[model samples]
Target: MKQDTALSERPAVGATPTGPDPERAAPRYTGGQIRNILIGLMLAMLTSMLTNSIVGTALPTIIGELGGQDKLAWVASASLLTMTATTPLWGKLSDIYGRKPLFQVSLVIFIASSVAAGFSTDISWLIGARLLQGVGMGGLVSLPQIILGDVVEPRERGRYSGYLGAVFGVSTVAGPLLGGFLVDSPLGWRWCFFITVPLAVVSFGVIQWLLRMPAHERTANKIDWWGATCIVGSAAAVMLLLSLGGKEFAWNSPVTYLFIVVALVLAVSGVFAERRAEDPIMAPRLFRNPTFVLAGLASLLVGVSMFGVMIYFPQYLQIVKGMSPTASGLMTLPLVVGMLSASISSGMLVSRTGKWKIYPVAGMLLVSAGFGVLSLLQVHSSIALVGTGVGLIGLGLGLSMQILILATQNALDRADMAAGTSAVTFFRNLGGAIGVSAFGAIMTNSFSSGFRSVGAEAIAAGASPDELAVAATGSPAAIHALPDAVRELVLGAFNDAMHHVYVVGAPVALAAFVVVLFLRPTPLRSHT
Candidate 1:
C-alpha cells in the first residue's frame, strides 16, 4: 500500500503535532494508543449493534412467555424509535460537553437498561427498558464514528473504518445465532439481554482507561433545548407513524393522518428552531454542504435497499423454503461473508489510494444487480442462486456503507464533526425505518392479492375455505401443514410477493447510484 506523503511524515510516537490549525486538528496519538482506543470503541459498537438484532430470534419465545402477541413488534420498534429520535441530540450533546463523558454516560445507560430488560416480568417492562436502551444506543452508534474522525486523519481513517465495518458485519451475523442459542439453552431468552452486560462493562472500563483526547473549547455553552425538543419530537412521531401506521390503524384512518400532521409540524418547527438556536442540535449549516446532502441522500436510499432485504429475506427462506429460524440465519452467512470481505478490502484500498468514489459507485451498481438477481427467485430456486443474490447485495453494502461516512467526515469542518456524522447516520436509519414499513406494506398487499387468487384456485380444486384461510393468516408452519396442492399454491403466492419486493428495490438502489454520481470527489485530508 502506497502512503500519502503527508501521512508518511506523521509525528513520531507520543508526539502531538500542532498542525496549521491546532484547534481543529485532533491530538496525534501513537499507534498503540490508537489501537487501544479502537478496541474500546469496537467493543461498545459490538454491544450496540448486537442489541439491535439479538432480540429477533428470541421474540417468539418472549411472546409465548409474556403473552403479548399483539404487542410483539414493539419489542423491536420501541428501541428503534428512541434510538432514531435521540441520535442527533446525543451527537450535539457530545459536541457540547465532550465525547468521553457523554460516551461513558451512554454506556452506563445501556448497561442499566440491559439489566432492566433482563428482569422484565411483562412485555411493557421489556418495551420500556428497550426504549431506554435505544437512547444509549444512539450515542454508541454515532459517538465512535465521531471519535474515530477526531482521532484519525481522513487519509488513514478508512483502514480503521474497515475494522468497524467488520465488527458490524460480525455483530449482524452473531446476534441472531446468539439469541437463538440462548433461547434453546437452559439460560433462556432473558440472557440475551444479560449477555451484553459484561461486554458493555468491559467496554466502559476500557474507554475510561485508554481513550483520551484534547477537550473542545466551545464558543457558546447554551444548550439548544427547544431545537432538541423539536428534533426528538419530530423523529419520534415519524418513527411511531412508520412502526404503527398500517398495523395498529388503517393507512387512511384519522390516526394515520394525525401522525403525519404531527410529524410535519414538529419537523417544520425543528428546522426553524435549528436556524434560530445558539447551538443547534443538528446544525443548519450541514444542509448547505453539498457533500453532506448527497451522501445523506445516498445513505437513505442505501438504507432502504439494505434493511428491506435484511428484514424480508429470512421470511422467504423460512416461509418458502421451510427452514427454521436458525437455519434461515445460517443460510444468510454468504451475505455476511461477502459484506465482511468487501468492507475490509475497500477500506484498505481507500486508505492506500485516498480515493473512494469508485467503490460506492461500483457498490450501488452491484446492489442494483443483486436486486435484479433476487427478483428472479422462484419457489424452487436453488440455494446457490439465493446465496449469489444475497452475497451480491452484501458485497455492495459493504463497499458503500463505511465509505459514505468516510466521505462525509472528510468533507466536514472540525466544528461540525459530531452533528454531521449523526446527520448521516440519522438519514440511513430513517431510510431503513421508511423502507421496512413501505416494503412491508407492499409485501402485505401483494401477498393478500396473490393469496386471494390462489385461494380461489385451491377451493376449485376441493381445498376447504377454512383451511386455506388458516394457511393464509397463520405461520410458516401452518402454511406448510396444508395439503400438497394448496401448500404449493400458497408458497408460489409468497414467492411472487417477494419477487415484487426485490423488483421495486432495484430502482431504489439505482436512485442511490444516481445520487452518488453527483457527490463531489473531495480528496481525503491528511490531517484530522
Candidate 2:
C-alpha cells in the first residue's frame, strides 16, 4: 500500500514516533482529502451512534412483535458485552497492522451484521446479530480517535473533535425520529436494522479511498490473545449476572451465586493474565496513575447515568404516558438539542481558550441535578415536563463526553496513548452495560412489586394474578390490553418503577461529581 508523506516521515526531534500528537511539519492529508476523510469518519461514527440508541423508542414495539418482553434488557446487554470486550483489541491491533485495513474490515462486519439483524425471526437471532454488530462497533468507535491522533495535532483536533461530537449529537437526534417512524410505518422494526447498510456502504467506500496510514511494521510481540479472551469471559460473566440475577432467578438462588463465583474467578484471572501479557490490552500500570484512575472512574459514572436515562426515558413516554413510538421519539428532540448544542459550543470554547477542567465538573453536577429532576417523573407528567427533565442529562453529557477523553489523553505518555484512550472508553462502555442491565433488573423487579401492591379492589375488578404478573414483564401492548382498572394499575406500576430507578441510581452521578472534583488539571498542549 502507498503511504502518506507526512505519515511516513521521521518524527521531529524529541517526539515519540507513535505520539498521540507527533510534532508534524504539516497535516498528513490536506484540503478536500482531509475533508473527505473526516466526512467518511464522521459518517461512520454516526452509523454506530445512531444505531446504538435508535432502538430505545422502538424497543417496546420490537419486543411486542418478537414475543420476548422478558428479554428486553438482554437486547442491549448482548451488544454491550461484545463491544466492551473488543474495543481495546481493535486499537491494539490497529497499532500493529495499519488502521485503514482494520477500519474497512470493521465496517464490513457492521454492514453484514446489520443485514443479519434485519432478517432475524426471533429474539435469539436478533441478539446474535447485535453481538456481531458490537464486534464491528468496537472498531468504528475506537479507530477514528486513533486515526485522528495519527493525522491531526492536539490543538486543532478540538475543533474537528467538536464536529465529530456534533455528528454524534445530530445522529442522536435523527435516529429516534427515524427509528420511530420506521417502526410505526409499514417498514416495521426490521427496517431499523436495514437502514444502516447503505450508509455503511458509503462509509466503506469513503474510508477505502480517502483514509491512509503509514505502513506499520508488524509487532513481534505475541498478541495477548489470552488476556483478551479472559477479559471477554469476565465481562460476559458480569453482564449475565446483571441481566439475569434478579429477574430470571432469585438473587440469592444457587444459580445467581454460581454465576457470581464464576464472574469473580474470571475477573481475577483476567487481571493476572493482563499482568503477564507482553502486550497487555490495558496495562495494569495505568491504575497506578491517580489521573488515569480518576478519569476512568468519572467516565464510568457518567456512563451509568447517561446510558441509564437513555434506555428509560423513551419507555417512560411510551409506556407510562401513552405516547405512540414516533411521538415518544419526537419528545426527545429537546434533549438532542441540549446535548448537541453543549457539545459543539464546549468544543469550540476549549479549543480557543485551552481550558477544560470546568466543563466536566459543571457537566457532572448538571447530570446529578438532571437525575434529581427525573426522579420526580410520574405517570401523568406532561410531555414538556418529561422533555425538560431529559434535556438536562443531554446537556450535561454533551459537555463532558469529548472533554473526558481529551483529559485522559493529556495525562498519559505518547506510548500509552492507545492504552489510556482504550481504558477510558472501555470503562465507559462497561459501565453502560452494567448500569443498563442493573437498572433494568431493578425496574423490572419494581414493576412486579408495584403490581402486587395494588389495592385488592383494583385486582378484584377482574385482573387475574397470573395475567398481572405477565403484564409486569410484558410490553405496553400487554399492559394496555388489560381491563380498565388493571390498565391503570399496570401504568401506575410502570411509572413507580421508573421513579424508583432514577432515585436509586442518581447517587452514582453524584459520586462522579466527587471524582471529577479531583481530576488533576494539566496545561492544554498546543499543536506542535
Candidate 3:
C-alpha cells in the first residue's frame, strides 16, 4: 500500500493548506484488513468502557470490603478527572508520534492499572489505580476514532463508526449484569476489575499483530509542555469543582471560588502558551473552521442530555417503581435496542448516500421529544411509556454521537485530524461532567421542595415528621418498607423531582438541535 504524502507530512506551524493534495491518495487496504484492525480496536474500546460500568455496579461491594465509605465517590471521580484532562494530550501526541504506538502504550497502562485495582487493599489504592487507568482509557476512547479517520474515507467511516457505537451499547448493557453476577457469585467484586485485564491484554496483542500505519513526519519535535500543563490543570480544577461543589463544599464557599480562579487562570495561560509554542497541543488554527466549532458545541449540549438521563433514569425505576437494581438494568433493554438500531441504520444510510446532515438534525429533535415524553412519566407510569421515552433518547444519541466527530474530521486537514477529533471528544466529556453536576443540584432542590409539600400532607394525616424525613432520604428498599401512605408520599416526591430534571433536559436538547442547524454540510471526502 502506498502512503499518501499528507499522511507522512505535517503542515508547517501556522500554515493552512487550502485542501487535500489532488495528486496524493491515502493508503489502501482490503476490506478484510480493515475488518481485522477494527476487531482489535473494538476489543480495546470494549475493555475500556466495560471496566467503567462494571466498577460502577460493584462500588457498593468494594466499599463494604475496603471500609472507606468517605472515599467511595473518588473511586469514579478520580478516573473521570484524569480521563477528561488527558484526552487532548493523547490526541496531540498521536498526531506527533503516530497513532499505533501511543495506542499500544495506553493499552499497557490500562492493563497494568486494572491489575493494580483488582489487587487493591484499600479505597485509596483503588482510587490511585483508577486514576492511572483513566490516562490509558483516554487514549482508548479517542485514538480509535482518529485512527479510523486515517485509514477510512470519511464517506465510508460512518459504517465502521456505527460498529464501534454498537460495541459501546453492548458494553453498557452487559457490564452491569456481569458485575452483579460476579458480585453475587464466589468470584466477588474484585473480579469486576480483574475481568477486564485479559480482554485488554488480548486487544493489545491483536493491535500489535494487525494494526499498521505510516509514521508521521514532523519538521520539529518540540512539545508544548507549558500548554499541556495548563490545559490539564484547568480541566482538573473544573472537574473537581463540578464533582465536589454541592457535596463537599457549598457552591458559594471559598473552595468553589478558588477552583474557579484556578481554572480560569490555567485556561488563559494555556491559550497564550499555544499561540507562542512551535508545536501547540490544540492548535489555534482549528477554531477558525466553522464545522469544528458548531459540531463541538452541538456535541457538548447533546452530552448534557445523554449523561443526565443515563444517570437519573435508573433512579426513577428503582426509587419510584420499586424495582431492584438487576431488574432496572433489564428494563433498559429498550434503550439499548433503540440505540443499536439507529446507529447501524443511520451509518449505513450515510455511507450509501454520502449526505450526513439530516441525521443529526432529526436526531436532536427526537432527543428533545424524548425529554418531553420522559417529563410526563409519573409514579405509576406504565412500563411501555417509560420504554418509549428512553428508546427515543437512545435513538437520538445514536444518530448524533459519531456523526458530529465524522463531520469534524471531514472538515479538518489531515495534519489536524487527531487534535480536532480529540477536541470534539473533550467537549462531549466536559459537557457530561457539567450536566451530571448541574442536574444533580436540580434534583436535590426539586426533591427537597417535593418532600416538604408531601411532608405537610403526611403531618396532617398523623405521620411523624421525623419518620417521614428518614424515609425521604432512605434507600429505595427502605422507602418501600415504610407505611403505605408515607411510602406513596415519598414516591410521589421522587417522581416529581425526576419530572423537573427531564423538563430541564428537554430545552438543553432543543438547544443542541438549534446548534446543529447552523452546521454547513461539507461534502464528505472520499479519501483520507
Best candidate, lDDT: 1
Displacement of the residue 478 alpha carbon in candidate 3, Å: 0.7
Candidate 3 has an lDDT of 0.85
Over the stretch 59-159, how does candidate 2's per-residue lDDT look in tens digits? 87879888788787678666667777788788777665667788888999999999998888899899899999989988888777666655665655666
TM-score of 2: 0.88
For all predicted structures, in order, the TM-scores are 0.95, 0.88, 0.95
Question: Candidate 1: what lDDT?
Answer: 0.87
| Candidate 3 C-alpha lDDT tens digits along 5-119 | 4434533322223454632344576688788888888989899989877888899889999988888778867888888899999988886676888899999999999999999
Give the runs in model 3 whose Cα sits over 4 Å from its true position. 1-23, 215-219, 459-466
Q: Write the per-residue lDDT of candidate 1 for residues 223-280, one digit (tens) a residue.
A: 8899888889989999998988888788999998888899899899999998999778
Candidate 2, superposed: residue stretches over 4 Å from native = 1-3, 10-28, 31-33, 54-76, 120-126, 171-173, 184-189, 460-474, 477-490
Backbone clash count for every predicted candidate, in the order shown: 0, 0, 0
